[model samples]
Every structure is written in structure tokens, then in C-alpha cells.
Target: MGIQEIAQATGLSKATVSRALRGLPTVAGSTVDQVRRVADELGYVPSSAAAGLATGRQRAVGVVLPVIDRWFTAKALGGVDAELRAAGYDLVLYNLGGPGGDRHRAFRRAMLRQRVDALVLLSLVLDETERRELQVSELPTVVIGGPAHDLRNVGVDDHEVAALAVAHLTGLGHREVAYVGGEDEAGFTVAVPYLRRDGFTEAMARAGAPVRADRYADGRFSFAGGVAAGAVLLEVPAPDRPTAVVCASDEMALGVVVAAHRLGLEVPRDVSVTGVDGHEYGEVLGLTTVAQDPEAQGRVAARTVVLEAQGASPGPLPPSAARLVVRRTTAGPCR
Candidate 1:
């Protein structure tokens, strides 16, 4: 059986029949369901090459993200893959290497060749030229983890996430708290680390806690970075050491805890620690943290772009939520 035969029998256009049978949202849901029923009854099958030529639509989605090996990125990809597959779309991934890896090459050279129907950008920062190129391409796009001009974005408020971590520590009567974070200013996409840092500083001031000069440290958002920052902060004599430390990410929080033990200090008893991200390790390490689900963010971003690619109009997308989780790594400061 063929599309024309199905269209003639159903009293629909061949174009409509072709689109509906393929599960493209360009057709109305009821019409699609009916078409599928007819196709099934007749045992009609679609030819892959003909369908592409007829619809001019690739059943594919492009995903751009950084650091594919990271837990957050992997989980986000998992969510994206599931959603796109359920919607009958394939995912084409582009991994931009870490800082200094020349991500612009993906935009300058590779992206145009892929001819994907839509794009989802996860935690990637675009410069002026790249942003202009993206706009000119006029592809259906969804942004995750941060903003892109006039595009739908899904993410947690970084400021609020950091504030949650600080509030948790301050509420426990810790007067001195430090922050371990990434390089918010250079070689990064958006100002996530900077926004979180600001949140911590503002929250501390509101709680009547002073962040001393020595209380701040900078490092990447990794276990090793956390360990380095942790050592710097905890190696101080007890009189000057912070009672609790807030980290920009959960991975860093775990590092700080290990640093505490190595320096002969007990968690919570000597130095309380908190971080952002509801990372998988948080439960195992008992690290208190402000939690946001990256997978859920990925799901939201994927759904948004896929629907838009299928011809649904774009609209407002509110940021995802973040909350605090208390665990064994934090307690009131030991006097």
C-alpha cells in the first residue's frame, strides 16, 4: 500500500497522509491516529527516502553540549535521547571540548552540514558571531542551563541555587562560611559560577555573616578542584578557619570533605560543607547541597525543541527549580 492509496481511502491529502503516518506533529493528533490505524489495517509501510523527499523534514535533532564525560552531561543526554526517540526523532550529538578546545569549529564548519530539524544547547555559551550565525540559520532551538536571545530556555536560577546553600549553612548558626567555585570570569560560557558566588555573598550578608577575604577560593568544578580549594581553606589554624564552606558544585563539595579528613578534621564537627547540584555522590558522601536535576532539564529542553520543529509555536519557558537537601556533612560550627 502507498500514501496516495491511503489518502484516497481516508479522503485526506497525500501530503497529510504521508506526514501523519510518520508521527510528525505537523499533522493533527486525531488525524495522525486515524492515519496510523488505516496504515496498520492495510499493512502499508513508508519508504525512508521518499518520506524525506516529500516532507523535507529530517527526523533528527541536534544536541550541543560540553564535557560529555561529566555526570550531568551524560544524564542530560540520557533524558534527551529518551524524549527524542519517543517522539520518533534521532539525536546527533556535538561535544565541545573543555576550555581551550575551540568549540567555534563546530559552528563554523560542522553544524550546517548536519541538516538537523532542530537544536538543543545544553550549558553552552555562544559568542556574538556564533549567536548571529545561529539566528540567521533560523533553526528551531532550545536552550538549557542559561539564556539565549529570544529562545526557550530551561534551567535553575543559579543565584537562588547558591543562596539556598548559604542559607542552609547560616541557619545552622555558622558565622564564618567560605566559598569554593570555578573561574566565573574567563574561558567559560555564561556566568553560572559568578551568579552562584554572588548569591552566596548576598545571602551571607543578609544573614549577618561576614565573608572574610581569605574565605574565598577559585577552582574548576571538579573533585580535584574542590580538594585544592578545601586544602587552602581548611589548612588554616582553627582560629581563622571558616566554620562551614559552600561549594559551587556537588563534586567540589565531595573534594572539600576528603580534604578535611586528610587534614585530621572531622566533617560537621570541624568544618561543615555544602554544595550545589543534587549529584549522584551527594547521598553516598552525605554532603548537604542545593539540588537541581539536570536530566529533568534535558527532558524539558528536548520536548521544547522537538515540538517547535514539528511546527508548534514557541512560548515562554520558565526556569527549573532548585532546593536544599541537608545531609551528614554539615552541622553547627564547633566552638
Candidate 2:
């Protein structure tokens, strides 16, 4: 049945019936119940497409991500999905394969088409062309990484998160710390890895244990990368070796642990290790880290975008808190 028929059956105006059916606050509770009952009796299935055409709203939120293979992506998507579903909205995911994918070209046109009501771009540094396009498009958008030119954003302060990890190591009386972070220097995202490295440097200097020139290693943020970099750090003479190391990600830290084991060195004895990212298994692995839940970050970003899409002027999203989780992988400096 149609909205008009439901309105006629309920003895109410079509506008009132529509608002009541949509659960708009303007409609009284009794009126909504009555409309729902009438709609139920008539087997009237409301057309979402018709509603979208009438209101010029798609009732969908687009979530853009850099990759879906990682654990963080899965957790973050879970948060985004739950939040959007609660708001009676659907999620349209767009996974840009990598930094320089030709597939991103499709989104440049699709976003301009205004297909989704709002968008949440995760871990992406928008290029000038895309930024210019999105700015003029006027789509309500929330970014899930660092500050994005005044856009609503919710993310862990990468610098502060790394600093917490460094502080934990230094507090344990560990000096001569090493660092393993990200894919090569040039492949790292604009603000992500650079800010993290900056934090490590600043925190080390504050604790009077500046990173040595040979202590830093660059590789992919992967287990294999960690193993390779960990070997380089451990291969140096015992007297000159760093007593502790900080990794930019959990996987990399785990790699270092594996490397240390293979080299017949006890964890936290030969070399303490710490990392960032709140991977669920960090506690199980007993790896000390500064945990920042990416899933929680996604939820905050979703809330901001959805509220703004519904015409509510929401303020900036709450910042993701950086938590220091102490596990067994870190300890006092090894002499």
C-alpha cells in the first residue's frame, strides 16, 4: 500500500503519517504507534527509494579505507557498521587498494555525484585534486586520521601515542633505544609515520637517551620487516646495542620478539621492546605498548558524520585516548 492509503486508513494527514512512520521526533508517540499499526495491517512496505527521492537524502554512509586486509580495518569497519546500522542507515565501503591506485579515479566522479549522505575517510591524506573536489562538493565528511583542513576528525594523536611508548621504555631505566617504523621513509604517509618518529625523538631526548644515528631502521610495517630490522639492531656489538626498542605497530614488535628469540636473547633482558596499536592479542603476547583502538576511532568518526548528515551541527569529534598497556616485553636496561 502507499503512504496516502495508510494516512486515509489511520484518519491522519499524509505528512503526519510519513513523519510518524519515520519516527521523527515531531510526531507524537501515540500517533507513531497508530500509523505503524495501520501500516502493519495493510501490509504496506514503505519505499526507501521513494523516501530518498522526496527528502533528497540517500540514507547511506560511505566508508573509505586504504586497505581491508589488516586487523585494524576489520575492527574499525565493525565499529562503523554498528553505528550506521543503529541510525537506520546503510554502509557503502570503498577500499582504495594503495597509495597510487588507478581505482581511486572512480571515486572522484562518484563522490561528486552525491550518492551517499555522508563519508568517513580512514587513514588517508587527501591529495590536492581530491581535496578541491570534495571541498566544493559540500558533502558532510568526517576524517578518521589526523587533522584534515578543518574537517571533522577523530583519531589518536600519533605523536603522543609514540611518546607514551617511549616513556614506558625510558621509565624502566632503558637507554640507547632503537626504533622500527613503517615501510621505507618515502612510502610513509605524510603525517602518520613522521609524527610517530618525531615523538620517539622528542621523548628520547627528554629522558636523556637520544636515539643513536644507527639505531633507526625503515621497513614495511609487517612481521617480516620487523624481523629484518630487528636483526640489524641486534647484530651490532653488545656494548653498542640499544637496550630497548620501540616499534610503530604491534606486528612489527612481534617480529622483533621473534628475531630476538632466534638470536638466543631473552626478551627484556637482552633488549626490551614496546609498540603502538591496541591489537587484541597484545596482552596475550605480553608486549608492552601504547594501545589506541582504531575500532573506537571509527565509531567516533561515524557518529560525527551521521549527526552532521541528519542536519545536526555536531562539534568536533572526541579525541581517541592513548592508553599505555604494560606487558612483559619491556624492562630495565640491560648492561
Candidate 3:
């Protein structure tokens, strides 16, 4: 029940038991094993907060994201949660949705309370001031999707990922391909949509395809946005229509598919479509896309944070490589 009781039960000194519980390497291996077993038998759940005071480690990582409702964020969180649980760390989730009020209160103000050992920002667009605040924490931080000032990151190259999506569509004989995505004004100060748009242009140029400004439709990164955009594109006259469309996210692609079906058009026959992020539903829709390993990104981010907590330097950001997963959504030029 107490440190003395644990020590007595394990036949070890109280100091040794204490050292073992703290995970200090000074204790002998056998002593630590005996102590841990005894503690487990006693149903001892060590107080992380109390231990943090002595070790200067909270044994937890804070994860800040724009919205948890989105498919991409949910997938990324799934990966992060699994990795942290396996590594004996806690994940403190902060959904920076709504207006700037909750986000500022949670991330800018309350986060500095020293509740977590490090922070993991998942695809948030932080401004200079916000970035400075995170830096002042002096805790290890790993950003997913883009670079954070004085912090390490792990994510696919957004530009390259978009390029791959374009290249895949072009390779399928889709010359007149349209791009559908929304503006990057969702959260924070980063310009992800703009970067992805640049990537799309670059990819189209390399493929010798026409990147029509009119072909690009801005929409929300949701199923409904996709449907609306899809309707607009489908409304075009047959001769003026693009043979294929590339969506910025999987949800958008699903919308395109629905729109095509509504117009009595068969996917890849009447019009081909592709998407990024490789959502679970993409397979059911047979949508072609570039798969970025969200789970792997989460694990790497967690490991980076944990290492930083242990006084290790955060490594360079990981590269974003796109692996094409072809399905029924895209095909050669319309017959």
C-alpha cells in the first residue's frame, strides 16, 4: 500500500524500491524486477504528478489539433494514441476548434502550466506569436505536416504528395483534370491549401497537362463540400468538362463520386477522380489516392516527443513520400 510496504514485500530497502519506481538506472535489474512485481501485486498505480515533481518529467505529451471530427485528424490521433499508450505515456488532447477563444486559452495560456513533458502539434497552422509561446515552453515539440520554429517535425512532403496525386491522374490519360479543395483558412496561420495548390500546379506542369484556373474549385474538406463541388463540375457541358478530377482530400473524392452517380455517370468511365489521405472509405469507393502513413507519422511524433522528454535532441523532420493506391475511381481517357 505504501513505499515501505512495497519494499518489505519485495525484501528490498525502501530507497531501492523508490529508485525502481522512479525508473532510475541506479537500482539493480533484479531489484527493480522484484520491486515492480510486488508493486503490481499490490495494485500500485504510481502518482505521475508526484513523480514528475522529483524527476522534472510529467510523463505525458500534449497533442494540439484543429479538429478531431475530420477524417485525417481522427486517423492521425488513432496512431498517436496507440503509440503513446504502448510507450507508457499519456496523451493530452486539445481540440483547437471553435473560435480563437478556446484555442488561446488552452494552447497559449493554460498549456504552460507544465502539465506535459512535451507537445505534439498535429497539422496546426501556428503564427509567430503562438510558435514563440511553444518554443518558450522549452519542452520538446514535434510538428506533423510542416516545420515549427526550433522544433522537430514528422510528416509527408505536402508538395510532393500533391505532385504524386497529379502524376497518377495524368498517367491514367487524364489530360483535362480538375482540382477540388478548400482554402487553408481553417485554423492557425499556416497556408497548407496554398502549398498543396502549388504542388498540384507543379505536378500538372511536369505532366504537360493544362492546369486551368477555372478547373480549380474551392470547397470545404468534407463530404458535403465535395458533393457541392462535384455538382458544379458535373454541370459543365460535356465538351467543356474535364475527363478527371483530383481532390485534395478523400472526403472530397467521395463527394465527386456521389455527384457522378447522381448525374448518371459511372466513375472512371464518364469521369475519373482521385483523392489524397487514403481514408478507410476510399477502398469501398475504389478511389485512387496517394497514401501517407498517418499511423507511422503518429508513432514517430510520439517517439520524438518522448526522446525530447529524456533530454535527447529532436531529429530532423521526416520526408513525405507518396505511394499510389489505384482503384476503380480513376482510369484511362473516357471512351
Candidate 4:
């Protein structure tokens, strides 16, 4: 059985029956129910390939990511999946596989193919070649976690997120502070870490606690990286050491806590620590942090791209929100 038989039985045109079967918004609810009932009664199974050929839409969205294993990436992917599931759209994920992955080939071979109707890029700053390729493809695109040169993005104001963390620490009267952050090891020049680092510097300066030259260490945005950087910042003479530390991620903050423990320092007594991104481990470890919702950002990006792909004009998206979540890791400097 097919759409033709269903159409004949329902006394509707084949076009209307097809649209109804595809669940196009233009079809009325009652008409959709009628068409579906007829199709089911006739034991009709709709072919996705036939539908795609008929409508010139693949009914799928592509999500391109620099990596797949990070906490932010996983959460955001879940959000995109949830929104796409609701919209009856499929998700096609393209993982770059970290550093040395053939991004050029991936862009040319996988994305340029007519597989997905829209695209969502996660935290990638496209190069000129990549940008031109995207333009050539003419796919409706949305970015999450970082701003692309000319594309719409859905993520928190990273600078402001860092400033919130800085303000929280400074308000507690901590003057000497160290910073832990770094770029992606996969060699993608992500903007989030740079923005957060700049925000930390500016906020500290504004609070009259200008960061010292030696107080900065690259945490590499990983727990192990954080441990290495944390030791460099904390294993110092008492007067020379920073009284508080601010990390770009909760994973790094947790690493700092571990490094502190290894060095026989008591948190909030010998030194205080804070982080960004409300990682679950942060709660377990009682780490103060400024939290932003990556999952919500993902949902927004998916929804926006899907709408644009469907020929809907959406307005510029406002930046996502971030706020301070204080816990036991921060305190006033020791007297």
C-alpha cells in the first residue's frame, strides 16, 4: 500500500495525503488524523527516500563537533537530539575526532553531500576555506558554545560568565588570585577559553586584584591538565602563592582541589578555588562556580536551524544566561 491508495480511500488528493503523511504543518489536524488512519488501515509504510525525493528535504539536521567526549559536547548533543526528536527530524553527527582529523576532507566529502537539511556547529571557529564551503552549501546553520564569523550562535556570554566567578571571589575579600585555562589540545582555536580568560583578567583588575604574571597556568581544559597546572600555581611559598584560584571549567577546578589535597593544603583555609560550568562533580566536590546550561544552548541551536531550514525567519537570539553558584570551595583569604 502507498500514499496513492491512502489518498484514493480518503477521497483526498495525492499531494494532500503526502503532506499529511509527512506531518507538514499546513495540513489540518483532522485531515492528518484521517490520512494517517487511512494509511494505517491500508497497511501502508511510507518510504523516507520517496518522501525526500518528493519534498526536496532530507528531514535531517547535521551536527558537526570538534570532539564527542567532552561534558559540554555530550550535554549539548542530548539537547539537540531532544529537539530534533520532537520535530520528527533525524540528527547526523560528524565528529572531527580531535587533532589531526581530516577536517578538510570531512567538510568536502561528508557535509557538502545532500544528506542534511540544516547544520549545527559546536564550538568551532571556521577557517576561511571552511566558511566559504559552508556558504557554497547554503545550508541553514547555527552554532553553539562559540560564535562563528557570520553565523548565528546560541551560548552564554562567556566573558560575563567569567566575570560572575571573579566577582564572587572578590566579594569575599580575596585579593591574590591565580587563573587556570587553556586552548583545546585538538588544536581547534576555540573562543570560549580566550573570552573567559580575558574576562577573568578584566574582572580581577576591576576588583583591585590584578593577577600576577606568574599566577597564570594553562589548564588545557581537562582534569589532568588542571592537576598539572594547579600544582604549578599552588606549590609555592606561602606569601608568594595565590590565595584563590579561578578555573575556566569545573573539571579543572576539581583538579585544583586534588592538587591542593596532594600538597597538604586545606581548601578555603590555605587556598580557595572556583570554576565555571556547573559540572556534577563540582557539586560533589563542593566547588564554587559560575554555571551555564550547555544543554539548553544546544536545544536553542537545533530549534533555530530547523526553523530556518523550513523557511521561517527567526530573529537574532539573545545570549544564554549564566549565574554564580557558591559552594564551600571559596572563602576570604587567610589572615
Q: Which lDDT values do the candidates have, in the order given? A: 0.79, 0.77, 0.76, 0.85
| Model 4 stretches astray by more than 4 angstroms | 1-56, 187-189
Best model per TM-score: 4
Check candidate 4 and list the clashing pairs.
Answer: none
lDDT of 3 by residue, 208-315 (tens): 885888899875777888999999997787878888988888888899999889988888888998888879899877889888877788888888778767767556
- Looking at model 2, residue 106 earns an lDDT score of 31
What candidate 1 gets wrong by more than 4 Å, as runs, is: 1-56, 102-105, 108-111, 148-151, 184-188
The Cα RMSD of model 2 versus the native structure comes to 10.8
* Model 1 local distance difference test score: 0.79
Q: Rank the candidates by lDDT, best first.
A: 4, 1, 2, 3
Clashing pairs in 2: none
TM-score of each: 0.80, 0.80, 0.79, 0.82
Please report how far candidate 1 places residue 191 from its true position, in Å: 1.4
Model 4 error, position 320 (Å): 0.7
- Scored by lDDT, model 2 comes in at 0.77
Q: Residue 129 CA error for candidate 4 (Å)?
A: 1.4
RMSD of each: 11.1, 10.8, 10.2, 10.4
